[model samples]
Target: MLIFWKPRLALLAVPKTGTTALENALASSADAAIVNPPGLKHCTVRKYRRDLSGFFEQKGKRPLSLVAVMREPVDWLGSWYRYRGRDALAGQENSTAGMTFDAFVQAYLQDNPPACAKVGSQAAFLEGGVDHLFRYDRPSDLIDFLRDRLGQPVEVGRANVSPDGDLTLSRQTRAALETGRGADFELWSAL
Candidate 1:
């Protein structure tokens, strides 16, 4: 997460949404940057509302406007599938090695998904809503927001990209995901 004190803006780092690149690009300008401990780096809206919001209000003498980025649900899951498929997690329970994208997404639609497919819902992360939200597919919108808010030229490159592959889901699995994760689809569609 990156906090720009002067702008009174807090950028919430939603996972797999190119936040690392944003952090790297804006770290020097941010009043505070939390880039360590994955949990803190990817602090969600709920956590911010419950914890950091009051703190920021006290410290900054005003409520901070929260901003976040979200990706399409299926592509987000595909990133998780490919990420866990990397050789580094080969034998781990969280590894998606040898699994098809369809199987990975099916696991994700489960009431209780296994570690490999338990990437949290973006809608849940931003359930409280934010002052600004950007779609990952349209990064230029985010860049424009950052440039205007920060009063500086902001540039972000791709970071933490998962393995490359054709991640096609089976028709049945796709249907299940769409039905099971309706909130995610709705949120993405609204964005």
Candidate 2:
């Protein structure tokens, strides 16, 4: 859950990667702080990255060492789709809940939907602008990496909600996301 990291640590919350659970655990167990953005529903890297240094300066906190969790694009998008699909159908009893796989893939690549707003283009994330990247699928390594960076031990287990549904992607969708979104996939692979 929570591990001290350097002086100021920013968990660049990439969405749908168990971020809420991780954030909850950290807030409860450690001296973790949340960025309080005025009049905004949520924070995105795009909203804050360019302005981060000043934000830190205003808070009288040093520049933070950043960490983020990434998931394999295929699995990540699969979970995203399922979660969104459920929400899309939440109030409608007989709605066609979600797009076809191909449509989802197209929208995922071309639209860059708001649901994934904070996640930037793969090239940017892969270029190491952040201090470290961790795999969401393999959280133990993420915890260990943070521990090493923080020079402290961290407990990296347990969750408030059991991840509700198993994620599944059609083979065609997987192949396309891997081939077309290879950069994002590779970023996680490198970590």
Candidate 3:
């Protein structure tokens, strides 16, 4: 997460959305940047409203507008599967090594997904609401907005990207994912 005090805007770092690149580009201009410990780096809007909003908005006397980037739901899941399957995570319990995309997705739709499919939902992360949202597939929308909001040109390069891989899923599994995680699709579509 990043806060631009002058703009009274906060950027929530949504996972699998190139947030790291955006943060790297915008950090210098931000009044503060939370970049360590995955829990804090990827703090949800709900957590912010419950824990930190008061400190920044009430005590600071500024009501900050929140912003985030959301990816197409299926693509987001694909990224998660690919990321966990990387060689670095080969022996880890959360690794997706030797797993088919369909199997990974099936586990993800479970009420209690296995570690490999435990990536949290984008919809749940932003359930508290946000003032602005941009689509991961639409880079210019975010870049242009940041340029204006930060008063400078903004550039983002790929960071923490997963290696190319097949993300194929059977039709039945696809249907299950769409049904199980509908909110993610809805939220991304809104962007």
Candidate 4:
């Protein structure tokens, strides 16, 4: 997450949405940057509103506007699947090493997903607290918004990309995900 005090803006780091690259690019100019301890780095909108919003308003005399990015729900799940399948996580309980993308996504749609498919929903992360939302597939739009707000160009390169592979979900699995994660699909569609 990156905060620009002058702009009274906070960029919430939605996972797998190229936030790392944005954080890296804006760190020098940001009034503050939270980039360690995954919990803090990926603080959700609810947490920020509950914990930091009051502090910012008290100290800065105004509330910070929040910005976040959302990826297409299925692609987001695919990234999680591919990420956990990396060699580094092989044999770990959280590893998706031998699992097919369809299996991984089916696990994700479970009421209680296993570690490998427990990736949180973007809609849940940004629920009710975003002043601006960007589509993950549209980098230029985000960059342009940042430039306008910060009075400087904002550049972000890809970071933390999941391993490359073709990920095809079975029709049944896709239908289940769409039904089970309706909020995610709705939010992404609205974006």
Candidate 5:
């Protein structure tokens, strides 16, 4: 017989999804400890318990569950691109800096592509078996859900700044995310 020791509830931080804001809120409201990811000096732990079966494992002494907060793909992608593109273009002049949004989107999808290896894919989230997912677009919803789950009133506030530029994905990437990597999002959009 195997026994599973549920640790505390694990919060899987997805990048650029108002995670920092939510982390601050949860940290203040619930007295939870936020674990920064390894290597990256300033980032949340996006991956949790790989052996636990993607998003399925929680490590604590009780039956623990998982929770995540994500944003609409369009906004999330745009913010991500600005943050990253600025960094990439820091030292280069006329280095595709003036490219059209469409061209940038094309390059983005082709080069980075949408993968769980970087950003948290919806497929990964669905397969991770998280107990509940809160949309960052609506913080109140997350707060209410967290209150019920954690047995405390968590104040979810707007802490992170919105993205600086338009972050719409190129047509190809949009189509793929809508149909492939983000099929779950598509379904949610339908409902």
Candidate 6:
């Protein structure tokens, strides 16, 4: 997460959604940059609301506007599948080295996902809420908002990007994902 005290904003980092690029682009202007300890780096809306919001609001003398970018559910899962399949994690328990995209997704949709597919959903992460939300595939609105508020051009170049690959899921697995994660679909559609 990156905080801009001037504008009273908190840019929530939603994993696999191009937030790293945003963090890199705006780091110089941010008052605080939490880029390590994955849990804090990807602090959820609930945690922010419960633990950090009051401090920012009282100390900064302004309520922070929270913002986040969310990716399409299937594409989000596909990114995770491809990310865990990297050669660097070949032997790890969280590796998806030999799994197909369909299998990876099937694992993710299970009642209790295996390590490789244990990523929490975007809907759950942003459950407490955000003042501004943007889509990963289309970020012009977010860019404009940041530019206007920060008084600097926002250029988000790729950072921590996933490897390129075609992703395909079986009809049955897709159906299961939709059934199990209806909230994600609903949230994305509303966005």
Give lDDT per model, in order.
Answer: 0.90, 0.56, 0.89, 0.89, 0.51, 0.90
Between candidates 4 and 6, which one is better according to lDDT?
Answer: 6
* Model 2 regions lying over 4 Å from their true place: 1-6, 29-32, 35-46, 57-61, 87-102, 111-128, 147-153, 156-172
Tens-place lDDT per residue, model 1, 45-114, is: 9998888878877855688899999999999888888899999999999999999999888888788989
- Work out the TM-score per prediction: 0.97, 0.67, 0.97, 0.96, 0.65, 0.96
Cα lDDT, model 5, residue 170: 60
Task: Give the clash count for model 4.
Answer: 0
Model 5 residue 130 CA deviation in Å: 0.7
The clash count of every prediction, one per candidate, is 0, 0, 0, 0, 7, 0
lDDT (tens digit, per residue) of candidate 6 on 27-104:
889999998899999999999888888887785568899999999999999899889888899999999888889989
Q: How close is candidate 4 to the true structure, as a TM-score?
A: 0.96
For 35-136, candidate 5 gives per-residue lDDT tens digits of 344322122223343443242333433444566666676566556556544545454542333444445444544545432114444444545456657776
Error of 4 at 67 (Å): 0.3
Q: Looking at candidate 1, what is the lDDT of residue 62?
A: 88
lDDT of 3 by residue, 1-191 (tens): 99988889989998888989988888888888999888988989999988888887876578999999999999999999999999999989899999998999999998998999999999999897899988888899988898888788887877899877799999999988888898988777766
Off by over 4 Å in 5: 1-8, 28-32, 38-47, 51-61, 85-89, 92-101, 111-120, 168-173, 187-191
